[model samples]
Target: MTATNVETTRVVRTSWLPLIVVVLTQIQASFAVNALTVSMAGITTDLDTPATSVGTAITAGTFGMAAFILLGAKIGSRFGTRGVFQIAVVIHGLAMLGVALSVSPTMLFIAQASSGAVIALIAPALTVFIATNYHGEQQGKAIGLLAAAIPAAGVLALLLAGWFANTIGWRWSFVLMVGLALINLLLSFRLKRVPAQPGLSIDWAGAILAAIAVILLSFGFSGLATWGVVLATPQAPFEVLGISPAPILIIAGLIVGQAFFMWLRRRAHEGLPRIFDLRVLATGSERAVTACMATMLFVGTAANFLIPLYIQVVQGRSSIETSFAIIPYTLSIFLSSTFVAYLYGRFAPRVLATAGFVVVASALTLLAFTVRGEWSQAFVVAGLILLGLGQGAIVALVFNTLLSAAPKQLAGDVGAWRGLVHNLSGSVGIAVASAFAVGILASSIATSAAEHPEISDELIAQVNLDEVNFITNEALAELLATRASGPELDAAIAVNAEARLHALKISLLSLAAISLLAIVPATRMPRQRAGDLPEKLEPDDDDLIDPVDEQEALG
Candidate 1:
C-alpha cells in the first residue's frame, strides 16, 4: 500500500479500544495536577506548610512541562515512540507515588516536576499516535475526544480528590493517581508502536537555551509579588541597578528566548538537527490556532487558580468544598468541549472562536460584578457555567484545527508547540492573577481605610500595608488584635473584606477585557463557511492525500 493509503486506512484496520486508551493519557495528566491544587488546604495542614506554598508545586509542574516538552518530542522520534511513551507512563506513576508519600513540600515539588517532564513526551505522542492510528473522520473524532479529556479529567479529579482528601487526608489523592496510571499502562498495551528512528539527532544546545529561557521567565513571573514587580522588595535577595531580580530575570529570559529562536533558524539553515522543527509554526492557521490556545488557556488557568484559592483561603474550606464549588464549571466545560467537535464541519473556526470569546468576556463580567467576600448568587454559578462552556469550545476547536491543519510528520512538533503554549500560559496566568489581585487588595485597603472614620490614618500608617497578603478572616482578626481593638478593629475588618472583594472584581474585569481583545485574533482564524476546512488542512486530509512533494516535505 502507498504511504498515503496506509495513513488513511490505519484506523479502519484497528480495534476501537486503542482510541479510548490514547485519551486516558490526557485524563491522567490533568487529573493529577487538578487533584493537587484542590487539595491545597489538606497539603498545607498535613505538611505544616503555608497555603501559599501550593502555588510553588503547581508552577514547578508547569515549568517541568515547558522546559522538557520539545526535548520529549525529540526523544519520542529517536526511541520507539510507544516504548518511550510507556516508560514515561510508568515513571510518572512512580512520581505520583512519591507525591502520595511526600514528607515535605520539597518532595512534593520534586515528584510533580518529574511527572510533568515525562508527560511532556506522552502528550505529543498521544496526538501523533492518534493521527498515525486513525484516519479520515475517525481522526477528527479522536482529536475531539483528546480535547474533551481535559475537562473530563477535571470532573473526575474534583469528584475523587474531594472525597478522598476529605476522608483520608490529601496524601491518598495522589496515591489514587498511581492506580489510574497503572490502569493506563495496562490499556496502553493495546496500542502499537512505530519503528525507532535511531538516526535522528537532537539539538542539545537549543534545548538547553529554551529550557533556561522558559524556566527563568516562569520563575520571575511567579515571584513578581514576593520579589517586587520593578523595585527591590525586602524578600528579594539582590538588586540589579536598584531593580528587583525578578524583572531582570524576565528580561534576561526574553533575550535568551529570542536567541533560542535565532539558533533554531540557524540550525535549520545549516541543515543540522533541531530540537523543534519550526515549519509547523510558519503558517497563518497554525499561528492562529496557537494564539487561540494560549489566550484561552491563560484565562482558564487564572480562574482555576483563583477559585480554589478563594474557597480554601477565604472560606477556610477543604478539598471537598473546593470541588463542589467548581462542579458546575467543570461539567459545563465537558459538555462544551465535546459538543464543539460536532460543529467543526458546521461553522467556520473564526465564527466559533469569536462567539466563544464573546461568551467568555460576558461571563467574566458577570462574575466580576457578582463576586464578593460573602457573595453567593445563582447568577454567579450561571456565569461560571458560561465561562466553562465558552472556554471549552474554543479549546476544542482551536486544537482540532491545529491537529488537522499541520502535516502528519510534524504532528509531534505541533504537539510540542501546544504543550509549550499551554503550560507557559498557565504559569503566566496564575502569576498575573496573583500579583494583580494582591496589589489591588493592598491599595484598595489603604484607600478604603482612609474614608472610614473608625480606621484612623495613624492606624493605617502603623500597619505595613504593602506587605499584607490575603489570608483568612480568622488570621486577619488575630493579626488585627496585635495592632488595634474594639470598633476600630471591626471597622478595619469590614474595610479589608470589602477591599478584597473589589480586588477580585477588578482582576476578573481585567481578564474579561483580555478575553474581549482575544476576539481580534479569533477573528483571524481561517474564514471558511459551514463544512469548509482551513486551506492548510488539505495537505494532511486523510481522505484526499495528494502525495505532492510539499505534503511529503514537512517532517
Candidate 2:
C-alpha cells in the first residue's frame, strides 16, 4: 500500500472510536453531577438542615472539584489516562453510595467532596483523550456535544429526581447513581489507554500552596457572610484556619503560591511538574477562555438560582409548580446548546457569545420591569426561555474556544484548568449574586423600618428578610394584616415592592456586567472552521501509556 493510504487508514481507526467514548463519558459524568441538584430540597428536609447549610454542602463540591483538578492531572501524568480514569470511576461510585447511606449531614458533605474530586479526575482525562484522538472540526463537535450533554443530563435529572423524591426519597435518588456509575464503568472498558509525557514529577510545594489558596479562596467566596461577619464584627460567625475576613491574607497566600510555583517551574529541569502551570495564564488565549467560561456561568447561575425563589415566594407557587415554571430554562438550554454549537463551528465564538449575552441582558431588563407581586406564567416562561437560549449559546461558544485555544501536549492540564475556571466561576457568580441580593434586602428593610416607626426593632430583627423575599409574599401579607388602615397597608406594599425590585435588578444587572466581561477575551479567539481536521487513526500512539499496557501490547 502507498504510505498515504496506510496513514489514512490508521487515522480513521484512531479518531472515531476514542471520540465516541470521550463524548459519551462526558455526558454520563455530567448527568451524574447535575442529578444531585434535583433532590437538594429533599435532602435538606431529610437531614433537617437549613437551606444555607445545604447550599454550603453543594458549594463544597465545587471547592473540592477546583482544588483537586490539578491533582487529577498529575495523576493522569503519572499513572496514564486509563488508570486514573478507572480509579476515578470507582471512587465516584463509592462516593455516591456513601452519600446515599449517610445519616449525618457531615458524612454526606464529605461524600460530596470526594465525588467532586473524582469528577475533576474523570473530566480532565476524558478531555485529554479526546484532544489527542480528534482534530479540527471533529474536536469542536466533540466538545460541543459534551456541552450539550450538561443540559440533557439536567433534563433527565430533574425529571427522575422529582419522580423519585415523590415516590421513594432523596436518599434513594442518590442511591440510583450507583447503577449509572456501574454502567459508565462497563462502557469505560472500551476506552484506550493514553500515554503520559515523561519526566513529569508532581510539584509537591506548588500543589500544596495551590490547593491551600484554592480552598481558602473558594471557602471565602462560599462563606462570604462568614468572612464579612468576621470583618464587620470581630465576634461574628465561625472562622476557618484562624482566618476570617482573611481576604487580604488569602490574596497574599495566592501571590506567594504563584511565586513559589513559578520558581519551581524555573527549576523544573531538576524535576518538578508545576501543577498549576502559571505560564498558561500569561497567554491571551487561555485568559480569554477562562474569562468566557466564568462570564457564562455568572449569567446562567444568577438567572437559574433566582427564578425558582421568585416563583415560589413572590408568586406563591408550590414546589412542583416552581419546577414546572423553570422548565423553559432547562428545555431551552438543551435545544439551544445543540443548535448554537453548530453555529459556533461556522462563525467566530465571539459573535455567538456577544449576541447571546445581549439577549440575556435584554431578558433580564424585561424581567426586572415585569417581575411583580403578581406574575403570569407566560411572563415567567418567556424570561426563562430567553435566559436559557442565551446561556446555551454562551456555554457552546466558551467550550469551543477553550478547546481550540488549548495545545495538544498540555491538553489534560489545560482541561483541568478549564474545569477549575468553570466551577470557580459558578461558585463566585452565585456568591456574588446572593451577596448583592442580601445587601439590597437589608438596605430596603432598614429604609422600610425607618419610615414605619410603629414597627418595632425586635420585629424587624426577627424577620428573615432573605428567606421571606425569596418565599411567597404571603409572609409579607401576614405582616400587613397587622395594620388596619388603607394608608398603612399601602406603605407596607410600597416598601415590599421596592425591596424586591431592587434585589432583582441588582442581581440581573450585575450578571449583565459580568457577561460583558467575556466579550473582550472572546475576541482573541481565531475564527476557525469546526471539524476542519480529519479524525485520527491512532490517537493513543503518541500519548503516554501505562507501563503495564505498553509491555502487554508489545508482547
Question: lDDT of each structure?
Answer: 0.79, 0.64
User: What is the per-residue lDDT of model 1 for residues 16-134, given as tens digits with 9 covering 90 to 100?
Assistant: 77678777788878887789878888888789765556776777788789988988877876777778888988998898898899989889888887888788878877776776666
Predicted candidate 2: what Cα RMSD to the true structure? 7.1
For all predicted structures, in order, the TM-scores are 0.90, 0.81
Error of 2 at 222 (Å): 1.3
In the order shown, the candidates' Cα RMSDs to the true structure are: 4.8, 7.1
**10 residues in a row with least lDDT, candidate 1:** 532-541
lDDT of 2 by residue, 425-492 (tens): 67666665665676676677678766786555655666555343333344456655754336555555
| Candidate number achieving the greatest TM-score relative to the actual structure | 1
